[model samples]
Every structure is written in C-alpha cells, then in structure tokens.
Target: MKLTTTSRIAGSAALCASLALAGCGGGSGSGSQAQGQIVDGGTFTMALNADPGNLDPQSSAASALFTISQLAYDTLLGVDPAGGQIRSQLADRWSAAGTTVKLTLRKGVTCADGTPLTARTVADNLTYVGDPKNKSPFLGTFLPAGARAAADDATGEVTLTLAAPAPFVLNGLASLPIVCAGGMSDRTSLAKTTAGTGPYKLTEAVPGDHYTYAIRDGYTWGPNGASTATPGMPDTVTIRIVENPATAANLLLSGELNAAQVTGPDAQRLDKAGLFAARTAAVLGEQWYNQAEGRATRDPAVRLALTQALDLGQLRTVLGAGQATPPTTLAAIEPLACPGGTLASALPAHDPAAATEALKKIAGKTLTFAYSTAGGSAATATAELAVQQWKAAGITVTPKPQSGEAINQTLFGTGDWDIAWAQVNVNSPDQIVPFLSGPGVPDGTNFAGIRNSEYDAAVKRASAMDGTAGCATWLEAEAALVKAADVVPFANQQIATYGAKARFETPGQLIPTSIRMLDR
Candidate 1:
C-alpha cells in the first residue's frame, strides 16, 4: 500500500549506460529528466497493467487508479524533484502547525468544467476523503482519520484540523488528489471519467481497454509551477489496459507503446535495446496475514510459524526472477525518508522444525493464500512456490488467485483471505501506519485487521515529532511488527519504466507534467 496497490514490477531492471535510441543517450536519473532539446505535438501511449475499474480519484489508492489519477487530478502539494522538500501545486502557499495545516489556493485556477476552484471547494474535497462514512481509501492513509477541513473563499485558504498530530502530513497531502465539488457531489460521475484540476482531462473512457486524456489548455498550476503549456508535452495521452507483460514489452520494442514499466524476463532485452527508462525502487514481495478473529492466522504463533516455514531468500529470488534485493525497510519509494536497516533483526529466521511443531498443535485447518494476478508471471510463480513451501511445513494452503480488484475486495470487503502477498509501496512511513494499525476494512483502509500495540504506540510517539525527526521510532515500529510476525517484507528492487521515443518522470508513478514526447 504505499495499498499503492501498483503491483510491483517482478523483474530486475538494473541501470546500465547504453547507446539507447538514435538521438537519446538517456537523461540521467530515471532518464525522464529533460536535458537537451524537447520535441512537441505527439501522443504518449502507456500500458496500464490493469483497468482502474472505478475512476474516482479518492476511492482507492490502488496502483492502477493512482497512476491514472496523477494524470487527471492535481494535489495541493507535490514532492519536489530534489526530494524531501514540499512544493506548491494547487495551493501556492501552505504550512502546518501542530495538528493544523493551511493551504492557500492559487488564483486563476479553474476546474475542467470551467468552474473556479476556490479554497472552499478544495476544503470540501478534503472533508469528503476524511469522513469515515464516505469509505474513501485515503481516509486514514493520507488525511488523518477524523481530520476535518474548513475554507474561506475571501481568504483563499483552507484550514485542516487533524484528530491527531501527523509527522508526514504534508507528504501525505502531496499524494491526495482533489476533485471538483460537482464530481464530489455526484460520486458516480467519477467512476467513468475524471474531474480534477490537473494538466490533463479524461476525454474518453473504455473499461478493460484504454482511457484517453487531452491536455488542458491554459493550465498553469502544476507540481512546483509545472505547466501543460511546456513544449514537448504530449497533446494526447492514452493508457492501454494491457494485462500481459510480454505483450506490453513487445509493444514497447515495436514502438506501439511509447512507455511501459517492464519487469518481466523482457526487461533485460529492453535494457539492451537502449530504451530510456524512469527507474525507482519498489517493494516487490510483502506478505500480509489477516489477523481477524476466528482466522487461523489470528494466532501469533501460527503467523510466526507460517513465516518461519518458508525460505524467504528463495522466495525473494523467485519473486524477482533472481534479481531482487533484500528490503531495507517497509517503505521502498525514494528518496528513503528513513534510510537505515530494520527488517532483518526483527524477521523470524527460517526454521522448519519450529513451524512443523506449531502446525502439529493446530491441525485440520487450511489457509487461504491470495495474491493479485496483475503482478505478472513472476508473482504467479512466487505464489505457487510459497504454497509448496507451506505444504512442506504441514500447512495446507489453498491458493486464491484473483484479479487485483477482486483481491482488494476480499481484503477490504469480504475478509476472505487468510494470507496475502500485497505490496503497499509508499515513500513515507506515515502513509503505511494506517494499514498496519487502525480501524479494519469496511470502515477504514486497515484491510488486514492488524492490531499490534507496539506498532500503535511507536506510531503515536513518532507522529508527535516533526517529519523524519522521529525516524528511529518510526523504523522501530516497523521492526516491532516484523518481530511479532505481523507482516513480512522480503524483497525490494529497482523497477524501470522504459520509454520508446518518449521521456517522462516517475517519482513514484508517472508525473503527467513531466511527460515529454521525443521525436525519434
């Protein structure tokens, strides 16, 4: 969840210098950063591994919807190119004090419907997401749970009052997309199209296939003063819902796809082909256990036993197709806010005997292991491998392979899975705290119903401190969860979004304002 619920790219895309296309040697750092001359007037086609299903910006933080939201919706703040610094987007000026945050909307900003986006409307959007009754996924993750907002049009400022202090409040706000009041009132309208103040607007919606967006005219407000009026920005953007990685890779190579995040076996060849890529670190393998009452995994002993039974090293290797690296912390998105090792000391060592003994006491119960199929072939293979490993320890695990949306529904709605392999990739630790501990699904985004007092206490302490100043405590909380076998994060690796005859920034996902159509 960083549920960024963007399924992690399952193969390694090691960065290596190459004589890429005819003119591009590759711009440094993700290669999407503009360097020399930039071209204009073209289409940038990309691959969406899965259809977003619902198009509401605030409905879910799942990767598919989140990626597209970055195109059609603009947040009040944004992560700066240098990282760690908050830059202006919809709000030209913003600040936080204690539990209160204020954002002054930029003048001359108009919604896609030509309605002026005042501070009052922006405040309403935040209020909609913060309300637990609305069931918006961003509730606890981005906006603090129970947070409320009020705006004054005359002052052009919106004030947010939080239920509790949040260390990374501004950072979380950067990821929260604001919708116009019209769409907010009629939520169903957003399920098909976009309604936000961003550089792009959704012009066509074709579910399970592709969605088309046209660049907004006279749009000036963007991440740190970014503009759609910039030269080389595509006139139209198309996101094709291509589930198969091999087909997507083939499209990338043949110039049918302008950009795609390829992490399957084809990544190696794509590197050799010298396609420009926007690369970033992502958590490829993370295991979660549903600790709801009556569930076998509700027992810590069973959860730990299950974790100990599997050889995580082999699992990591299988998950990444042999190119994965050990995850240093829970958050893998760069620039790492808490950059210190915290996963190993806490994780249970692989000991099959202990697992076998624990299982001996708890017999005649089978576990439902689930994972999203959108993770490509490597993820599927990794899931099967895990089942075999569990079976070895005398644990019977029935695999529940489902589409991304289906699995999300089970976790957040049905509570049908005993264990899941989901990657919630976020840059900040605060964003993940809600999932680790808080109100469980149905009402909140805490899908697993994890109730770890240590993690909760540590989060409370860390939240009082400003920003990363509480990193030690924050990381301690992460380790506490792992130590308790609350969750297991096994693999992390760099994933590249290759661009063919195009270039774009993916700080985490693609930045709409950063996309540049290159003339090859």
Candidate 2:
C-alpha cells in the first residue's frame, strides 16, 4: 500500500501556510481572497510532461499511465496520502486469514456503463492480472504469483487465495486498478476507452494532445469518504501533454494551465512567484545490469568492478544538484513500507584501484550503456560521467540515448543492452520482490537475470512475517544482493509539482478527490 512520508505531509503543510499567507495579503473586498471558499463549475487544466502511452492499466507500468489511469478507475482499496493506511474504496471492508483474503464490495457502486460493480467483476480483474500470458507488468509486482480469485455473487464477497505467503497482500490489492467486465473482455479498446467506477469519466481523449474527463455526479464512494459532489470540485478536468518543462511553466504563468510538475531552474522561478508546490522524494540514480548471455555485465566480478569504479558521492552531488539524499533501498519513495539501515553498510565502496584489479581478467571488454533522456541534460551528463568512470577501470563503453518510451521498449522488448539506468520507485518493499528475486525478463520482472538462492530464501522468510516486522529480514536480503553488485542505487531527490490559478493537495501526484477550482 502507498504510505505518506513525514516529509510529504510537511510539504503539504508548507503549501497550505503559503496559501493562507496569500489570503491575508490580498486586497480588501476581493472575492478571490477568501480562504477555503468553494467555487464550482469551472474547468481545471493540467500540464503533463509526456504523452501517456496507453490508458490501459494492465498493459504497462509507466508512471504516466498510472497517473492518468487514476482519473477513470478505482481500486479495491485506497491508500491514504497522509498516512499509508489502507482505506476502503470499492471494498467496504476486508479481512485476511492465512494466505486467503476476503473483500466485500461496497453497496450501490456502478461502472461508467451503468453495470453494477459486482464481486465477480473484482474476481475477473484479479484473475486477469494474475495470468502471465496477459503480459501485464503488474503480474508479480502488484498481483501475487499463483493467486486465484473466487466470487460469491449472492453475498457480494470475493476471496483471494495465494499460492505462497505474501506479507503485503493488502497493499498489493490496493495498487491493482479494477477493470469492468466489458473492458476486460475487449482489451484492445482499453488503450483509448475507459470503463471504471471512479469520480470522473473519460469523455474525450486526444492522444499526444489532451484528455478530458467530466465529473461523475452522485459518486459518494472515494478515498476517505470523498465525493464528486464536494463543493469547489471541478466540473471538468483536462490534461494537456506538454513535454517541455519550461513551456509548461510558461503556460501556468500565462493562466492557460492550472498545474504542472516541473524541475530545474524553472521550479525555482515558480517558487519565487508564490505558486503552490508539493514535493515527493524518489530515487533518481539506479543502474541495472542485463545478465543475459554474452553480455559483459553477466560476470559478477565485472558488475562489482563497474560499481566500485565510480565515486558515488560525487555522482550524487552532480546528478542531484547537491540536494539528493543517499538512497536506502529500491523502495526509497515515501510512506516507505520498510525503512531502516539498509544502505549504510550494504553498498560497494568507491575504489578505482580495486575496480581495475577486479576487471583485470576482462580488460578492454566493450559494453553498451543505455539511459533515458527524459530527465533532460542532467541525466545525459550523469550517463557520460559513468562511462568515463568505467573507462578509467579499463573497460570500453558505448553510450546509447533513448526517449522514455523508447527506453521502456528497448529494456523490456529488445533486451539489447548490457547496462541501463532507470528509476524503480515503488510504495513498498514487497512491490520490488519480483524485480529482485524471480525469473528473468521475457518471463519476470527480474530484468537483471539474477538468481541467488540465498537471497530468495531470505525473502521467503521475510514474506511470512507481517508489516514492519519483516524490515530486518528484507534489509538483510537487499544487502545480499548489493554485496554481490547486482544493482546500484545512488541518489534520491524531492520532485516538486507547481500550481497557479488553482489550489489543490498533492501527496505524490494530484489527488483527484482533493482538486479544487480557483475563483479566477
């Protein structure tokens, strides 16, 4: 389940304080100056950094897809942004016994097409995602392996049976977006159309341009008892894809856009302009080695050597603009399910001499390095620096740059590269289990092709425990992977979203239930 960090709550508090200050400083008798006043019936426009590849939740794990999917779909459970508590959504309440979980559907919920949301529908969603043949990236990441869902239509209850123990079963269910029977039956149509029981319904979609959603009136079931009838809730929401951060910032300043998440110098300028800012911490520097045959990174010593050659501290400073934190785990993003001393003694040390010695057996070997240009110039520069560091250890490197979409295709489809830099942020440690210990690529999330029996055994031990009780075992398992140089995570940074002509709350992305239209 997604949990909120203290830092995220603090960021929201700070934004509220700034809004309060703005209210106090406004001119007398101005209607727009009134704090907490609910003004309804206006369109809220948002600027997005990339075109969401597909609207289908089961198709890909791209961040853009997740953000947009929320507008049209509701999950079995909702996660509180302030605290990581599992809140009721479509399911009114739930209980678990051993590896079986039973959820009772909330009464009076209906899909966008007017069909009643039943236990059978929920069961269908679970079964579809649990199947590997579906090629859903969420198979093992969100839906546990060998999971079977059965529905009791008369009682409106759905039971989930897991093949093995999963410590974070509820959290995984909370992340799975439920699809209607019609949508499930016709998967190809989901790329453009939506069929969900959410607060908003997708009415218009223009790929590469914008998407429009209209409020679903009389909708009372939402995260934390939220409703579409709440005062000041926008009548219509529009998401415009603007790839350039500066262009998005300019649109916000010109009053053409209400909100946008931005970074770099543009963020500083927006901050000075008194725009509302919400921040969430996420890991930015993560490198995964492709262990498929014939790849130079397949050798453990070479992987260890490549890791040891770089000065991580210097790299963090350069890549993070001197503001990023040292990552503690793959699930570094907040409301962290398992947070502890995982990094202090686990990561490899920076030593060029040691790296050179380790690479002596394979000196002059050439490897292709892949990275995305989505983070702008900073990411490109960081990859270049890594190449130089590897060269110092007597390794030949060829750098390949790809757009964000292209990177996902190349990494998951072609599997043509030796090493790749990508972000693997998730809300819980359990979400990353598939990526760390499982079958490799074409079949599992373990893109690195890593298979360590000791690591797998440690994870199995941790899975039997509950919640934070498993933190120690989880950390130990991660340490085993790091000590072997399987994966390297360097920097974590606070990503900020800026707003103007609107006031809203954001835990990570824009909260659909908390959005409000300004009295402009």
Candidate 3:
C-alpha cells in the first residue's frame, strides 16, 4: 500500500494517446456548456470498477479504498501533485530536526462525530498505525517502524520520534489518513462508517453495490486550504460499482454517469465521443519471483533465466497496445520523488540464448506461475505470452489464473506461487524500502521473499541523505536489485477517467478535494 502521487492535471495529448483514443474534445452534452460555471447543488454519480473490500484505510492496500477514504479522513500533510511538495492539511505547520518531527494542528478542526480534533488524537492515530501489534499494513511502509508520538493538548502540538531516520518521513505522513479516536478504538466500525475531519460524511454503504456520502456543512479544513463551501462542490456523491468498462462508458455518454474510469477499447470510444478525460501514469507490468525456500524461483539462476527469456519489447507492445512507458523503477507513478534513468542500464536485456544456457542447469524443473485477471484481457494475454516464452526456454510453467483477491491471498497468505505478475506503485523510492529489504509475507509486504544485503546496504546509504540528494544512490541501489533479477518492472501505462458533467484531479487515484460539479 505504498502511497503514490497526488492528483495533477495531465496533458490532453498524453491522455488521448495513452487510451488509444483519436483526439480529445468535449462531448455533445451539457458538459461542454458547463466548463467554467460552478453549480450550487447536485448529486454526482461516479462508477467504480469494483467494490473496495474494506473501507478502513489501515487494513487494506487497495487504491480504491485510499481514494474514497480521503472524503472522511485528512492527513497531517498534503502533497502538491505537480511537484511532490508537502503541503499543510490537519497540521498547519511542521518542522523536522534529526529523527524527530513536530506538527502543529490547525485551529477549529473537528471530526465527523463533532469531536474536536486535538494533538492527542493525532498522536493516537500515529501510535496506533506505527504499532506492529495492530497489524496495520501501513506500518513500516507508510509509518516508519518503532515511531512513538506524544501530544501537548494545550499547545496543539504533536511530536513524533522515529527509531531510525526516515528520509521521506513527511511524504509518508502525508499519506497516512488520520482516523478519529472513536474510529481507532472500534476498528470494525471503520469498515462501513466515516469518522474523520474531511468534508464528507458517509450516509449509506451497501457492500458490492454503492456507497453514498453527504457533504458536511460548514466544513472548512482541507488539503491546501480547500473547503466544502467551494462552488461546484457536490451536495451528495454516489459511488456505484459498475465493473464493465463498456457499460460505464455508455452510461457516461448517455449522461447517466457523471464520472467513471473506463479502460480498454471502450476508452477510445469515449474519447471519440469527446468526453473530458483525466490521465495519470502508473506501473502496470511488474514481475516478482518468490524467493522463499522450496520455490523453483529460489535459484538465482532460474530467476535470471526467467526474466531474460521474455521479449520485453513485444510483451510491452501487447500489454500496453504499444503505448507503455518503459519502467524506470517501482516508483513509476508521478510526481516521482526521485527521478532517474536507472532502467536504461539496470533492466536485463532480452536474450533467449542466454536464458536457454542458464536453464540447462535446471532443465527439468517445473514452476507455478500466477497472475490476476483484474486487468481484464490484457492481463490474461500477457500471462499466456509469458508462458509460451518460458516453455520455449525449456521450463515447464503451470499457469494459475486467480482473481485479484485470490492472487493477494496466494502471494501473501499461502505462498503457493513461484512467479507472479504483481505491480507495486509508489511515489518515492523510500516507500518501497521495506518491500525490498525487510521481512516478507505475514510479517511484511515483501511478499517476494527477496533478501539482498547489498541492496539493503545501498538503501541505507540513500536513506541518510535528503530525498532529492539521494537520487543517484537510490538509482544505483535499484540497479543492484534488477541486476540480481529480484524483480522485473517492464511497463508503465496511463490510466484515464472520463467525465460527462464533472472534472476531478487524477494523479493515480481521484483526489477528493478536486472533485467539482459542472453546471450541466
């Protein structure tokens, strides 16, 4: 659940080209007429591709959960999507000295339950998420391990002490949604309720169907000083689960759906129809090998061989419809905290001969390959192609198709698969440190069971420096991982959302603060 980029507007050409669309223009509807004008009240209907399994931000790593959680909860900091700079949210001001960070809470902030938000409450949220006993997925990933927080109620200041120096501490804190004390106490209630200081309150939640939110009146505190009273702010928002992309697009064209993320061929049709679309770059093609004992991929030679067998150029073409950006690192989502050209030198060259030579040492070994169908046809096709390539290289591959949930269960639960098509998108290199260097499976998000001391050492070196200053060292560290074939990040694709009568900021997920109702 590494937090990626904040929502920023993308170029029209990039948006249209990524979706394989013809061109960009407003559709023949009220949306065209409603461009600049803001309406007072309207019910904004959005189509979600799938239902978020849990609403508790601490429990799930799903992007959908993070997007919706923004409506109810606010973090101490916010990110400027254009530059990845930290902005004030719940915390009006913050200062970091050594391994300690001090945050000053904003005035007049209150939770949805009418409880005044205090430094103590903020401290409680941090301590709870940082504690390993709570089994928060964000622990070690978003919140640094062994972080202790203390609050001064009278001064509205919270002090966070970290066990180790975290380079991107502020960026990590920006992604940690602050849950109210009541919600934190009763974690189960958070699965279907809202209890934070955001602009919306959950009114109704029907699992696998829809979740509705009503705007909170007099709500003023928001990221970057945004407010609920802003013009075009929706009085109500209905997020309807409509999995079919074509259906969602048709609904958008018919003016039934105000906003929806439509992928595949349907996106082209929507673009041709001239609907307003927002796009963001995200890593889509990533391969991880299970390095745990007893797995066929445990052998470094086998892992390297498998990676080298694939025709990555052809695979990228097939997976991205020839529009994929060659991956630079796992942190491909923009606004990248550390940008470099590591991929040009780090990624393994596609050489079937080299793969064949390496495979001879373990010629008869069979491996189980798992992939999720969550990406629809493109995912299935890519898996099949990989299987063919692996077979040609003298390795027997047992293709196992799993639903997204089942894939997560198998990779992190049963540990049954040897190879996986898993995508890990993060905004900063430090966010992926635990996944690459720490414990694996039930203990951590490093599901691949990778343990490279050299890579870990490089990461430690990079962590000591400031975020931007460590780019060269971070890129070198990533190269170590790729050179060892610990993971293969191949393709990054653009994801777009079509709007019929609304416009919202989309970096990786829709920014709740940016949603605006059009006067259609």
Candidate 2 — which pairs collide? 1-171, 3-84, 3-335
lDDT of 3 by residue, 389-503 (tens): 9999888888897644456567667999898776656667777776677878787777789998888988889888876788888888888998888988787777667787788
- lDDT score, candidate 3, position 414: 95
User: Judged by lDDT relative to the true structure, which candidate is superior, 1 or 2?
Assistant: 1
Ranking by TM-score: 1, 3, 2
TM-score, one value per model: 0.93, 0.89, 0.90
lDDT of 2 by residue, 155-201 (tens): 99999999987877887777678998889889889989898988888
Candidate 2: RMSD to truth: 6.5
Deviation of model 2 at 164, angstroms: 2.2
Best by lDDT: 1
> Which digits, one per residue and each the tens of the lDDT, describe model 1 over residues 346-414?
789999999999988678888899776656677778888889988999989999977665666677778
List the candidate 3 regions with Cα displacement exceeding 4 Å.
1-36, 360-366
Report the Cα RMSD per candidate.
Answer: 4.9, 6.5, 5.1
lDDT of 3: 0.72
